[model samples]
Structure formats: C-alpha cells, structure tokens
Target: MTERQQHKRRRGAGVAAGVLCVCLAGSGCAQSGAAAEDAREGEAVQAVRSAADALVGARSSKARTSMEMATGGTRVTIRGEGVYDFRRQIGQLKVQLPQDPAGTPDQRPIMELLAPGALFMKNRGAGVPADKWVRVETRSLSDGNLVTGGATDPFAAAEVLRGARTATYVGEDEIAGTPVRHYRGTADLGIAAQDASDGNKESLAAAAKGFATDKVPFDVYLDEAGRIRKVRHRFSFVNGQMNNAVAVASTTLLYDFGAPVDVRLPDGDDIYAGKIAEE
Candidate 1:
C-alpha cells in the first residue's frame, strides 16, 4: 500500500477504537443507573418496614386526618385532629364539621370525641341543648358508619404498611417544614383490615376506582427516625348499591409519638338524657 493509504487506514482504526470505548462507557453508566435504582428500591422497603415496626411498638400519637370524597356531583371533606392510642384502638379527635351556609352567624364549629362504644358530640345545632354533649351508643349504629366503627384504630397503620407489595423510593419531601423521605408502593387490598368498619374500608376501596383491585397505589413518608410522617391513598369503588362508585382520597399525618392523650368517656350528666337523641 502507498504511504498515504496506510496513514488513512491507521486513522480509521483509531476512530473505531474511540467509538468502541464510548459504547463501553455508555454501557457502564447504564448498569450503574440500574444498580442505583435497585438500591433505592431496597432502601424504600427497609424504610417502610422500619416505620411499620415503629407504629406497632408505639403506644400513642397525635394525629391529623383529612379525606375528600366526590360522587355524583356531591363533594364532601372531613378533617380532624386527635390523640390516638394504638393499643386500645380508641381516640378522641376534634372533628371539624362544615359550616351551614344559611345558618346564623353566631353558630360555632362542631367538634366530636370518638371513643369505643360511645361518641361525644358538641355543637350539634338548634333543638339540641347548648353546651351539652350528646353521647351516642355505637352499638346502635350500622357497620357502615364511620366513627361508630374502628375508623380511628391505630392498627390501621400497620395494615397499610403490611399491605405494601412493591415499594420504591420516589424522592424526598417535607411535611410541616420537616424533611422526610417518600416511598410509594402498590398495596395488597386483600390484606386490608377486614375487621375494620365498612365505612373505613369503603373509603379505601373508593379511592381504587379505575385501578387494579389487587394493586392499589399508596404513598408513605418517613422521618429520619424511620417513623411515618404521613400517608396518602387514593382509590375508586364500583358498588351496586350506589348510583355509581365514588372516587375517594385520604391523607393521614402522625406526630408526637408516645404523647399523652387525655381521652375520657362522657360524664353521665354530659350525656343527653332524652330517650332518643339525634347523633
């Protein structure tokens, strides 16, 4: 070969080597990315497990809960702050009630205390005695009722965590100005607490509409201590009983672990003495 031809051949060989090296580097990067993703997934699972364990071991906590529901042109929202006792499955939450648009300006917001077998409601409105607590016996309420059942049970947290099937670290977030790690996963609906009241389960099922029943998605945030800071769930329902299945979404935040919760059953005088009191 001529000298010029030989030089061109060597330049072509050098270009091929450079291309090969580039391809190899790209492959290494791809592998590293996959490994990092796997590590993040594993970390998510461990974080969730740790939070679940902490919830199971905790005695009590201060909790805030909010749920928004939309069905058939109607929208409803319930928000509350309370003290929850995990061991007893009972709590005293001050639930906030919607204001009456046409009601008097002097009307005060409603608050309720939910305990096992009984509920103490305040500000139930006119015709009901003022400054008195209306205690409703839970046994008379149907299984589909909210507070009448175990809606406030702390064990529900365990149920949520345990039901997670495949979890992945989504990213980091902050709740109430505190930094937290967020993990998202698909939940096993069959493992949801069957012993809980239908109202509670219904809320969960309602959020799963249009999604696979076996794999309802849920998100949980944990603090540095591996304690759950917040949990969010969305699902939809298709029930024959309603005009159409409703879409439901719920969020729960937990803090002040092991905090003292002063929960008391209603006093005899505080209970409405009437034969039939509206709850």
Candidate 2:
C-alpha cells in the first residue's frame, strides 16, 4: 500500500474514535442529569414526610378547618376554627354546619373536644342533652372520625403525610402571609397506619379499610421550618344511605404557632349514655 494511502486510513480511524468518544460523553451527561433530578425528588419526599414531626416540635398552633362533601348532585360545606396541641394529640373546634333545605338561619355551632382515642361533642343535635357531651371512640367510626366529626383532626391530618407514596415539589407560595413550599402527592392510608403513632394506629387502620380506596390524594404546604401550614386531602367512602360513593374534600390551615391549647375531656358522668338519634 502507498504511504499516503496508509496515512489517510490512520486519519479516518482517529475521526471515528473521536465520534465514539463524544457519544459516550453525551450519554454520561444525560445520566448525571437524571441522577440529580432523582435526588431532588427524594429530598422533596423526605421533607414532606417529616412535616408532621416539625409540627410536633412547634408544640401547638391555631387552626381553621373546612370539609366539603358531595353526593348525588348535592354539596355541603362545614367550617371550624380552633386550636391544637400536637404534642398532646388533642384539640378543640367549634364546627358550623351548612343551612338546611329550607335555608334556615344558622344553627348553633357544635363544640368538639378531640383526643387521641376519643371524641367528645356538645350540641351535636342527635337528641343528646345539650348540657351533656356525647363521647365516641375514634377507632369505632368508619371514617375514623375524619369525616364524622365534620373536621379532620389537625394532628391526624398531618400524620397522613407520613404515607406519601409519590410527591413533587410544585414551587414556593404563601399561605396566610407566610411563605411556604407547596407539594403535591398521593398517600397510602394503609402505609400511614403502619407508621402512625400508637394512639392513631387503630383509627387510621380502620379508615384504610373503610374508605372506598386506601389511596388518599393530598396537597400540602410547608413553611421554612418544615411545618405544615396547610393541607388538603380528598377522601371517598361509600354512603350507606344512598348506596353510592361520596366524595369529601377536607382542608386544614395552621398558623400562630405556639398558641395555647387547653382541651379538657368530659367526665364520664357528663357524657350521655342514651341511645342517640341518627341524622
């Protein structure tokens, strides 16, 4: 072979090698970018899972709650305001029900005392004496008192995030004038029950079984301290009366961290034992 022809062949080989090197380098860069994205997603999920613990660190906070239920083309909204003690797993709320079909004047608000394993209510309007409180076991309620009480317990609502299966950091936002990071996710109720504290274990487990699906979709906002400023959960359960599924959207907003919350349970004598009328 001619020397010039040999030199040209060598040159061609070098060019081919260079092209292969560039392709490999590009692949490595793509992989690195994907790995970084995965790491960011993992951090967001970890932040969300730890939000409940952050609230516990804050001790207590003032809260506002709204629960909207839709069934058979009818929708009703219930609102409540109160204070919660995360450490004690207790709180108090005054819940106002929507107006009746006749558009009657607003009814007296139902005063509720929320505890770890029990719930107490006065003026519940089921034939119980107004002066007496009615006590119910949290685990006994089909929805685990999440829907029955007309408001989700603040701490319990936070605990639900413990089961976040998938999460994405949406962006920064403000809630009630406080800067917060918004996250969207879906949580598994069964998984939440497994990781929940002893006081909430049975109740959450019951909710997991009673709901139409164990999956709960939620949007949560967290402050700089990783505390939950707001959370909204969408729950669905079968309505026994209508023999259809009812959709419920429950929202809880927390602010005024370090607020005083004094929730005293009623004495046994102060609770009514009579058969209560059904709604």
Question: lDDT of each prediction vs. the true structure?
Answer: 0.63, 0.92
RMSD of each: 6.5, 1.5
**Backbone-clash count (model 1):** 9
TM-score (all chains, Cα) for each model: 0.63, 0.95
Off by over 4 Å in 2: 1-8
Q: Per-residue lDDT of 98-146 in model 2, one digit per residue for the tens?
A: 9977889999999999999889999988798899999989999888887
Q: Top model by TM-score, which number?
A: 2
Tens digits of per-residue lDDT, candidate 1, 190-264, equal 544332334235433332332324455678888887777898766544444563545556667898889887777
- Judged by whole-model lDDT over C-alpha atoms, candidate 2 comes out at 0.92
lDDT score for candidate 1 against the true structure: 0.63
